[model samples]
Target: MSWTERQRALLGAMGLRVWGETAPEHALATSDAGLEDAAAPASPSDPDPAPPRPAAPERRRAPAPQADAASPPPRASPAIDLGAVAAMEWPALREAVAACRACDLCQTRTQTVFGVGHARAHWMVVGEAPGEQEDRQGEPFVGAAGQLLDRMLAALQLSRADDGDAASRVYIANTLKCRPPRNRNPSAEELHACEPFLVRQIELLRPRIILAMGRFAVQALLRSDEPVGKLRGRVHRYQGVPLVVTYHPAYLLRNLPDKARAWEDLCLAAGVAEAAAEAAG
Candidate 1:
């Protein structure tokens, strides 16, 4: 239990002491050897450091090309043959009308209300079809609606005067020449069958403006599903002539509030008519 022996016991517990009765230098040398053994290099079987990761592949983007400014313009379709129709005499046209049966409406019609107005009219008003009153009268507008229309025309300073120029100044027609049962709307088949006559009448009269009154009339002319509320107040073109859509007199009769809007539309139509007449003059 001496100081040296106590030092040796402490070093032995730490596994750095040599079990031998030796000198201080020998013991120090043995302790150095023990420390070297504890610090020996690890085995070759241990895992190696992971290899350096390869860089991500570069993404090749396709370049955007510029549009060609020198491309040729698109070609348009041939214009409709309106001249051939314009050359047809009124008597010949009337004869053609007399023998027409293009639609089922022809079967029920009392007479072909072909149209009434100036043959060379600048303003043409087209309605949906003849009603009970019109069928009985052989005219397009002769009922309460017709009376309203007459008043409307008079307001615009025009009339049914078959005088030389007047006869050629105001024309009227319908989408269908015949009256549907019970004043109902004309069917698509009826409208399709009768549309050619209207087209022909427009071509012959060469009206500067067409007033399409009512939803049916607007739809037939524009071939669109848009409601009359949306269709009215704006000017549209049909077969080179301007078309102004307005509420039918019959509809205005039932809906008094809409009369104000209808009046504005009538004014628009009148303005168009006046402009056309002035241009023609």
Candidate 2:
């Protein structure tokens, strides 16, 4: 299919080579652009949480104190009420995330990084976790990496911060609400604690497509430990929602060649979203 002026601009912004009369069709996708090398894991202070992986640098904060195995598990003060959180409206849900102390991260995070975007968007971008910038700003997809993500989404004609058409809008959230301290691997416990908020958010937003970015987010959503390269170019499901997987923008920044692949994933997602919208219509 021919590209639109907007499509050309979107691909241009993402630094993808425009294929004049060389393209096929457009599609949809979602993601969390973090600040780090994609090959190595890095922590972030403002954006999506950097996964605990081999090595790299990001918005690193001092590691949180690890609980002693001999000591009794830390008691969650005012434990999160899963049922209550699931039943909350947007206002109540926001407050629950803000006050949540269900995991050790609550102690280190400056503030909880709740999601942002159109409440009823058809597309949802789910990242790994909160980063330094994300924690401080109380928003996801900030900083340079976020800029890249915006470009990617623009290629698909979507935005997380817009009052544009609902079908063109996006809602971005993270698998983990708070940053996993330093480079420490986020525990299964931490993921379990935060799952409710994301689950409820999905239920509330009822997005048509979900873009899972980063190893952790992909793992959490798809329940797979496969490398992103193996998982790309295919459709997955999260709670029956059509999901597309791609590398985090942070990874793309370091591995420039992958931009083309990311664009392909975006195109795949766009096609899926378009098909879904048509069916619903």
Top TM-score model: 2
Model 2 TM-score, all chains together: 0.77
| 1-281: candidate 1 lDDT, tens digit per residue | 12355445543443332222322332222122222111123336625322232232233322232366686422211121223333567776665455555455656768777788777777888898888888888888887888777766654555655456652356888888778878778887677655656777887778877889987887677775556787676566777677778888888778867766665666566555555566678
lDDT of 2 by residue, 1-281 (tens): 45588878767765675542434443333222211123333335524443443221122222343568897545454346666776899999998788777778887888888999999899998888877788879999898889889877766667887477889899999898888787366887787667778989999999998888888788777656778997777777777787889999888889988988887777777777777888899
What's the TM for model 1?
0.66
Candidate 2 whole-model C-alpha lDDT, 0 to 1: 0.75
Model 1: residues with Cα > 4 Å off, grouped in runs: 1-87, 164-168
